[model samples]
Target: MPARDGDEPSFAVAADRSQWRYRPRRAFWRSRIVRAVALVTLLALCALVILALVREQTGTEGFLVGLGLAVLPVPLLMAAFRWLDRVEPGPWKNLLFAFAWGAFAAALVAILANSFAVRWIATATADPGSADDLGATVIAPVVEETAKAAAVLLLFLFRRRDFRSLVDGVVIAGFTATGFAFTENILYLGNAFGEDQDLGDGGIGAVTAGTFFVRVVMSPFAHPLFTVLTGIGFGLAALAPRGKRLRRVLLPVAGLLLSMGVHALWNGSATFGGPLAFYAVYAMFMVPAFGLLTWLAVWSRQRELRTIAGVLPAYAAAGWLSPEEPLALSSMRARRTARAVASRTYGKAGARAVGEYESFATTLAFLRERARRGTVPVPDFAAREQELLHHLWERRATASPALSYAARATGRVWVPPQYLDYGGYNPYKG
Candidate 1:
């Protein structure tokens, strides 16, 4: 049946079941929950395998020591990324998957590939020294960056909606790199401990201390910094118009290449000019680059807020939202205040509903803006916008009052219209 005057538009085509040529033999496996469970199980298996391999190489005591030390920076890095994503946070499941993919699958691939390449170079060239140098400066960078990038690419491809913005790419990539760094640190620290034991040092050995200082204390952000370049590329690609396929493909490749070059340069610093070169690169290049990227990520986050504020007024004018909602939603402080007011008045459920409303509103703004720009396909945009609007409508009872109060409290100063009853006003219809 065709849509009626009061009905939302239907973008989906109706298909006849009798006309199907083929159907899945195992329909149960096609469910999203089933696919998710399978993916998680696979990642867990990879983690177990990698853990076993590392333990075998490092020994039990070394593995334990490495595990303890390597965990120090994980929480800090994860927290920093999570903080950056506060404006429009992606689902935690996506973050978790990225981390697991990095920690297990990507790390495992890097280890196997690097080790194989190094061994092959050693045998073919009859020079252990050359193999070690080549692996560090060439093979390791290419392999590890590519391996880590796989996770980012997978998320970008499979979770396109959640992976919409630059901040989303950065956060997802950061989590993946954090996991990769954590696993890599474990291996490096564990090996250093093993070497220390070989020297019969009863206490804290020089090798172990040096590795810990470098990997944990000094340059814990090293891996994440490298991968974030690739993420920036994907984020930019996500913003590209749908017709610009070449730009989309080239952006990510350019980012991956840049990541590989930087990784190689950092690795080769020690070989080029010894300790002075390494420190010089760290002080001059690494520190400044990290600072620049940090600024960019934060600026992008603020830009998202500005975008929301700019685009949402149209929806408000259309009666999809209260007049004061866009202003209140754009300010992070106001958003928080709104949630707090809901929590105080209606307890946890109200707070949760308010949070959902905020998310839906922000998402709707983004979708509509993209639609206007022709970046998102029309049908997909229509369906997603309608879905988000419906969600916002459902929670408006709890969310609107809180947001209106927030707007007034934050100085936006909305007065109730004399013609409409403020308490019972129906602000939206789907």
Candidate 2:
């Protein structure tokens, strides 16, 4: 029997079509083959470059020593950034790409460009020391920050959906800087180790200890903090109205300039008033800046949750969401409790359902807010809204009851399933 004209693919095909539709997509960039090749190529190049450079400067033994010492702070910095991103986690793929970019591509660009510019200046000026200082204070900061900024820029422009808020930018930037620092530390620590060896010093000598104290303990956050300014700019740009093209353009540039300025100031500190100037700047300026940024990141997460709570009431009115869900989903604790209760009662699938429910519900809130603000594209809104609604509807049977129970147990809100049977106002209901 022959199938009818429209019978082969129904409305499900509509969704499939939308999902596959061409929209200036950069799918080639996302292909596994391309990604794997690119990653291997970049990582190999960077490894070779860093390895040779470190070996040349530090010798094999010093390189090994540096590798050991430099790795101590890497995990802590990575963990801190991951912790800051807990509220609305971006895809790990994005993070991995950012890390790879910083480790290999950005570092490569910074080193090569800085070296060339320094040599050029030294040849022209006939003063190698002054050229080296100028390179550190001006050339290196601009080149390195711009190189690092490429990762954020790519995410901002190509991975727009992944970069919805300020925290996303901060995390991506932090991770990128962390990667760059990891490579840079290997060099610095290796060099310090070689210096100590040459000075006939044994054990953890004065030079090695001093370098570790300065780079690892006192200023591990230096790179991340400088680049965070650039991320902040891109983040603000992401949040701004797209129609305000001027704002969109200016914000990120401003941020990059600020990053460069601060970086130059940090580099020039040694020449300004010696090591005391570095400590003064670090204490009076950098520490406070770091604190303020941390506060801002945490505060932004809370604001995001509040935004979810505020916009979800309409879905409740339309029966897409329960009356209690807005509150339950908003509180991170309640969300966790819901997952736990679901898993306890119905096992892993139940837990997964509840998790997806929470995620879809959050997406719904953000979408509605974007639509209300007239920023959401008209062509995409209806389709995205329908897709999210369908997902929530599918998970509602298992997840809703569990989430509601969790909400009640957590003392956030409650409406027993039995209570609605009465249908009346129930003014006396507890």
Candidate 3:
């Protein structure tokens, strides 16, 4: 029999009821056990750190003071990097872990390896007394840069998509460098504190405070800024056309050379009485170079926005968006506005879905650009594009009901069935 007017189809109603009834629940005890294990592991690591620090030093006061001083500059430097990462921000947890790896794991390895290399080189050259200078100028730069840069390289290996541009690379690289600098500073500050203890408390406190001021305040950017240049090189290398393997290799090599040279110059100039020469070199060379590179990043991001805007017109015409909506989609402001509409209509869950859809769109744009430039293999590109499209559809479906309601209330339809079809939103028949 034919379905009656204003009456729901029996099969459609049954399917909707089944969907509502389908809820997958996990065993509560299993989840609790996993959380318990993770908590224990974290506690174990903390215990190990405390044990190691206690065994290595005579007094806790100097170490605590050093740790306090060392941690102060990290947040400020991280904020600066965050400002630079506006175009493509990384996952905060991943970024923080990278920083921790650089500060603790890399710092420990670098100090050991650098010390060993310096000793070996000095002995081989019959210049035992020159070990400290060699370590500072040559060994330290090579070891520390490699160690800190390793954090960024690891990020590339694991989370390649997070590294969309030079600024993204610089942010990760800077955080890693900041981590290394923090740990190293703690050691130096702790030693200074201990040394000061031999003198009167006033004298010790004054000297320690002065050293902290000069190191942490006057030149906090020294290490992170140096490493960020190399990161820019790595990011460019990652985005270079696939066939230009040699160019990719050369870019990072040149960047590393630039990093080492800057580091050596910084150390060399510090040996002099004043920073006049260092300041001149930085102002004349480093500042202009970094400034130009930063300008290029901003220009590239703007170009990306224009490219996305140009390409999206076809979808807009197909009813996926209004003509004006495409213009809005080209800006983060508009994206945020859309998210707000989703939230007000459907609550936080709908807002989250909207955000995910936006993220998927951004990823799709990046991948498409890479494919167009031949940076990604053409054969695999289609599959990746489809995967991103599927995710976009799922997120859009979650946000769609609210969006449709909003459109109706305002008498300004933004997305209709034709839009859904254009966006590949195929409903599950099962």
Ranking by lDDT: 1, 2, 3
Candidate 2 stretches greater than 4 Å from native: 1-36, 414-430
Candidates 2 and 3 compared: the better one by TM-score is 2
* Pairs that collide, model 3: none
lDDT of 3 by residue, 34-62 (tens): 75576456545744564355326625777
Candidate with best TM-score: 1
Give candidate 3 regions above 4 Å deviation.
Answer: 1-59, 122-129, 202-204, 272-276, 282-304, 397-430
Residue-level lDDT tens digits of model 2 in 12-126: 4135544633233458878767977976787788768867876787888888888898889988988888877766678898888888788777888887899999999999999
Residue ranges of candidate 1 with Cα displaced over 4 Å: 1-27, 412-430
Residue 164 accuracy (lDDT) in model 2: 80
Whole-model alpha-carbon lDDT for candidate 3: 0.69
RMSD (CA, angstroms), candidate 2: 5.7
Candidates' TM-scores? 0.89, 0.88, 0.75
Better of 1 and 2 by lDDT: 1
